[model samples]
Target: MPVNRTVNVSVVFNCVQNGANDFGGSATYTQSSSTPSDLGNVVDSNGNIDLRQASAYDPSQYNDSVDFVFTLAPQSTGYVTPVVWASRNGAGATIVVPQGGNAQEFQVEQSSATPQLLTIVDNDDDSNTYNYKPAVELPNFDHYYISLDPRIVNKPSSTNK
Candidate 1:
């Protein structure tokens, strides 16, 4: 027998200008399959993506897993392209990681457009830094998810260095 498969993938950028402020513009792109077709029908002028999961997931129903979160910030204006890779214990959560809480959560941010690529590298590897490697693989009977957020960090209150 032979195996063939086609994966239809899409990404939605929840764009914002500065901390939590709306961009006051709209983005035209296809939303991820995790979202419904009719729901993500509009990317409002406020730069808000309408695609949202209607139901809540029960964490207790699955095994231990990591939730990768990527927040991208662009220097100026250009189409934003993002990528994601997953692995076990690949990265750290600088904001919220309780002493023994869910170490499964990890977060990273790309503050400038200069660094066009964001790669997750494990501590063990020392070569080929550009490689997009996942520290862990999908676990059996476990649930995992990725949260991609695009926002601008520059605000009027920012100071020049």
Candidate 2:
């Protein structure tokens, strides 16, 4: 039996199917390191590939690229699986910090945007702790960039919420 080589892959955001959709009003992409990075919150974690700044630059609007990395464990499994998914952060309103910014005010107009880049949380052990354990795949050294759907950049007022 061939053992899958354990390696780290970079998680990037580009564009995907849909091409059109918005979660609330802000679009989010979670890093492979298991962090929900907002549009402007660019960051990296232990298991991340350090692709680009969350709000680094612009690539069209609705259409964007994103992906999760897979790390193989020496001889644990011959192959690993990795898949991505999209979801609505909130209703019509973009994702809000719930409690932030002045007392009663709104934050950035880019939280609950659609085509959110959600993380593949491993809920195996029954514990709700978000572990950066994503489905790993056979290491090939090859890489690709996937995009996320785009929507409107809701720039509402602080009191809009």
Candidate 3:
């Protein structure tokens, strides 16, 4: 049997020049009592989070979910709004905005083994121009990107009772 894993990620954005140039952002996995071991080791040295079950298991049997919490520096708390861009292989993943929290909180559910890219862009002036936009509109700075690559371990046998 496969298992469902949950990973919590904390995103911090430092908006400089009102998110114009030289803006910086980072994301790190947050540990909690309910965090799964597989997802716990998700973060790599390069800061890329890959959703893969280390144990030998079939990918089809498991689903990985991520909870993202976004926070901006005090200077840009009300000035900049971060946007999430899930463009590469994004169709295989599902994004949900949780209620009760500010606009920065959201969840991502991924069931496919295909790799996907989620980019967080700092939206200054609180404009909607960057919302749900394509990758081509992504700015060069003041943003962070996370790579999701789910790996399949064992293949399920075709013949079954």
TM-score of each: 0.20, 0.19, 0.30
What is the full ranking by TM-score, best candidate first? 3, 1, 2
**Model 1 lDDT vs. the true structure?**
0.24
State each model's CA lDDT, in order: 0.24, 0.25, 0.30
**By the lDDT metric, which is better: model 2 or model 3?**
3
Give me candidate 3's TM-score against the actual structure: 0.30
lDDT of 3: 0.30
Off by over 4 Å in 3: 1-3, 18-34, 37-39, 44-47, 52-161
Model 1 segments more than 4 A misplaced: 1-26, 35-53, 62-106, 109-161
How high a TM-score does candidate 2 get? 0.19
Instruction: Report the lDDT tens digits of candidate 3 across residue range 1-161.
Output: 65544433333323333344433333332322223444345433323433332233244654332332222112233325443443433332332222222334223333224223332322111211111112211233333333333211211222110
Lowest lDDT sum, 10 consecutive residues, model 3, at 128-137
Q: Give the lDDT of residue 36 in candidate 3.
A: 42
- Per-residue lDDT tens digits for candidate 2, residues 1-161, read 22111112233322222322311111222333422233342233333222232333222322232323222222322122222222122221222222343212212121223222222211111111121212211112122222232221222112111
Residue 30 displacement in candidate 2 (angstroms)? 16
